[model samples]
Target: MDTVAANGTGGDVTAKIAGVQALLRGLTILDVLADSPDGLASLADIAARTGLSPSTAHRLLSTLVERGYAGREPGSKGYVIGHRVVHFSTSVRRRTSDLRRLVRSHLEAITAETGETSNLVVLDGKNVVYIDQVEGTHALRMVPGIGSIFPAYTSASAKAILAYQVDDAQLDAVFTAEPRIKLAAHTLADRRDFVAALTAVVKHGYAVEESELAEGVSCIAAPIRGRNGVALGAISVPGPTQRVLEPAPERLGVLLKKHALHVSQALGFRQLSCAAG
Candidate 1:
């Protein structure tokens, strides 16, 4: 009986070891693809980056491609990052209960102070997902329902968070992978213009979007940082474009920044300062 029990334990340990090995191999494939310039890496490139033999790399790549965690570039016969990564990231963001709870009061206060709708959004891969919201006192107010997802480039909240959190290389990869699609006349269409806007946001401590998300709607947003001084999400106050454009964008920007800082402090973030120009 003791011998049978020992055999069972050994079998369990062997299974666990195999699972960890597979996970490590999968992560190696992703790291190799992520470092590639055009998001494509040849089998040789992947093998070199992962320090695995050609046959081993091929086997892992084939498994990743089959499971949708990697993809093969058409006509190039190279490997690249895949949509499954984004899907998995989104699922993780959606499951963050602490972030939603932490920013709830900030959203409410912004709505109370500005008489405008407020939203809290978190980065989900290259996009932003609204997780919480507070409606304004006014009967007619801009509304972005909770759970709505928007492009990180076009939304003020998204840009505010992205500008602070993502490195230039990651930002470049984002734009290259999913080019901005204009939702309104004021939306940025060119890559250089978009980069310029992000630079401006970094300098100003907050970002303002004038009818970039929807016609007749605008938003002022500031980033919420975590204890590690990394941006975790954003807080935004949104209203009609006419009201936001009324020669007082700076005032709105200031209010948003203050509220965002309050939330960031509550979340234990210490590096609260305007980005240098």
Candidate 2:
């Protein structure tokens, strides 16, 4: 031991080992909590699941909570994954292939259910670019191939995303770039009309357009939200006006909103009003 100290690495090695052990134990606790059926676990549940003594679990949990990696369930003795964890997850998913794969399933589901083209779009300044698509089964279906770009204010998908994601300053910037680009008779004419349309999207939780972007095309879309309730992008179903608009647009809007919420949740988004657990 004296020789080990003389080498000046005895305490350093011991501390590193201790730190590694603590990290493993902490990660174990997180895994236990994550695998909980409803994302809620009590102290005893965590201890038993992690194979740690209750005292040890409690001490670790206290530290985790302080660091915002864990949170207490309001009105109960349960624990939940904290917003910080979700934020980290969202950030990673946004930039990786994981988000596209995760969203692909929902897009396929929407196309199957609606018999219309489903698209995944992300905002790029004043434009919304199509990143992925699940073509409709119908031979005459509308398919905006991947990488298609459109003015944000004219497309249902773009409006749905911008409504939840943009602020007044952002809107001003958008208008400054493209004041108006009328594509059809029903296209919104100016900034005031576009802003009003966006406001309606916020109230309805979706957006719809009838031949606003292309002749005889219609679309309904919902924002894919993040943990902070801001839009990450949008999911949309686009098809012929005859099929999409013959039945009120609200009907399709409801379906789009439902699947969009599922995708958002899969991305670890949770409404602030919801209980932590």
Which candidate ranks first by lDDT, i.e. highest?
2
User: Model 2 scores what on Cα lDDT?
Assistant: 0.78
State the lDDT of candidate 1 residue by residue for 184-211, as single tens digits.
8787656677777877787888888887
Query: How many angstroms is residue 206 displaced in model 1 relative to the true structure, after the best TM-score fit?
Result: 0.6
The lDDT values for all models are 0.74, 0.78
RMSD of each: 11.0, 19.3
Model 1 stretches with alpha carbons more than 4 Å out = 1-94, 272-277
**What TM-score number comes out for model 2?**
0.62
Q: Write the per-residue lDDT of candidate 2 for residues 1-277, one digit (tens) a residue.
A: 6988999899899999999988888877766665453568899988987778999999999989999989999999999878776665555446746668878988989888878889888876666667778999898987757655566767888778778753566566567652354768788758888878887888888988888877888888888887767788889888888888776887788888888888889878875553321
Model 1 TM: 0.62
Please provide TM-scores, in order, for all candidate models, with all chains considered together.
0.62, 0.62
Residue 64 in model 1: lDDT:
91
